[model samples]
Structure formats: C-alpha cells, structure tokens
Target: MSLAFSERARAEIDRLLARYPTRGAATLPVLRVAEREFGGIDDDVMVLVADTLDLSPAQVRGVFSFYTHLRRPGWGKYVLQVCATLSCALRGCEGLADHLEARLGIRAGQTTPDRRFTLLKVECLARCGESPVLQVNDDMYVNVTPAKADAILESLP
Candidate 1:
C-alpha cells in the first residue's frame, strides 16, 4: 500500500517548509511531520518524505537513524530513553536501565510485548547535573532512580 499525508498534515508541513529557504533545509521538521502522519518512519514513509522534500530516501533515513528520539515501526505507547552518557552512568544510570529492563521485561532496543513501553539507552538528556535521567517521549525526568522510575511509570496513563 502507498502512504500519503492527510490534508491537514500536508498544510502543516507546507507551512513549516515555508519557514526554510529550501526544501532540503526543512528536512527534519518534514520528517517529524511524516513520522507523526505515517505512524513512524519505515521504508515506505521514508520514500514519501523524500519525495515531499525533494530529498533522497537515503538522506531522510540518515536523519531518522541519527536521532534516537525519533520513533520507528513497532514502537510502544511510551518510549523510555535512559541516558547512558558518562555523567548519567556515574549516577547509577546503569542500575536504572536494569531496573527498567526487568520491570518491562525487555532488553534495551526492544519493546515490551504489550507495546506499552520501549526501553532505550541513549547519550544525554542535556541534564548532566541531574546525572541519571530518563526521557519519556518529549518530557524529561531528571535524577531518576529505580524507585522514581516506578513512580514515573505509574504516572503514565
């Protein structure tokens, strides 16, 4: 089957593209829009994004693969990105990741069977002072301990 953005999504992407001087310059936002529209960037969606932005599919895939924050196919309702940078590692981020893995029953880079949560070990949340940090979707959780992580999971709807 083919992929296409809704009219509203197209209009939104067009508006965003207008802000940039060239379509190539608007790649990231366009990918974001495509990700949201096509329900995460798979091969077909990448082609759609490339055609929309006048970019190569490889170019679109490059940007998508570079950003761990971007969702992919089979991602769950909540994406748990645990920082694995030096600062976070120093603050017991490894234990935090272990806790999440055991609790979610999935290893890093894997999604839960129920698709409620997907665990990941990433670079940084840009909150070094907080040390151990976890990013749930667009929201950041600083100073996250195993206990705090449980509470955070409970807080999710």
Candidate 2:
C-alpha cells in the first residue's frame, strides 16, 4: 500500500518545496512531512514521496539512507541524541550516557519501557566548544554533566 499525506501535511510540503529552487531539493522536507504524517518512512512512503516529487524510488531511498534525520522506523516522542565524538567523549559524555541509561533503564539505541524516550549515540552534534552536547528532540543542550543530564531527563514530560 502507498502512503498518503493528510491535507495539513500536503500544505506543509508545498510550503517547504517553495523554499528550494527545485522540488527535488525539497526531498528532506518532504520526507520529514511524510514521517510526521505516517510516523515513519516505510518503503510505501518512499514510493509515495517519489511519485509526489516526480523522482524514482532509488533516488528517494538514496537520500533517505544518507540522512540520519530520516527515520526508517518509529521512535519515541523524545529522541536523546548524544554526541559521541572525541571531544564529547573527553568531556565525560560516556559517563553522562551511563547515567541516562541507569536512570531510564534503557541503554543507548533503545527506548524506555513506557516508550516515552529513545537514547541514541550519535557521531557529532557540531558543538566542539560545548563538548558533551546532546540534542533532545529539536533542542540542543551543551556542556552537559551527569547531574545536568539527570535534571534534563527529569524535566521531560
């Protein structure tokens, strides 16, 4: 079965495409819209997007696989992506990650039992100066200590 977008999603996709000179360049935004509407980018959604944008399935899938933001499977409401690069590692990110795991009872790459959050060990959040950076949903938190991380997680709804 092919994926279909809600009227609101279609309007958002149109607005997103208008920002780019070429519709093809709006693939990322379209994918995000599809993901938000359908909850994830399945094979059917890829084809649907390709059809909507006049691209091929191969083209859609290529771009989808290249971007980490395009999720192939559904995730929890909160996605906690910790920077695991050298700088972040040196700043005690691993310890913070351990604390998160212990407190949430879910390891990296897993979701909480209540399905409220997912912890991901990501490559780099591009905050070297603010080592030990993490992105929760769309917000970035930097210079995180275990205590700060605990407080952040505790504050989540």
> Which candidate has the highest lDDT of all?
1
Per-residue lDDT tens digits for candidate 2, residues 96-116, read 888888888988999887778
Q: Please, what are the lDDT tens digits per residue for candidate 1 over residues 47-72?
A: 88899899998998888787888789
Task: Using TM-score, give the best candidate's number.
Answer: 1
The TM-score values for the models, in the order shown, are 0.93, 0.84
Regions of model 1 farther than 4 Å from truth: none
lDDT for each of the candidates? Answer: 0.90, 0.86
C-alpha lDDT of residue 115 in model 1: 91
Error (Å) of candidate 1 at residue 51 is 1.5
What does each candidate score in C-alpha RMSD? 1.4, 2.2
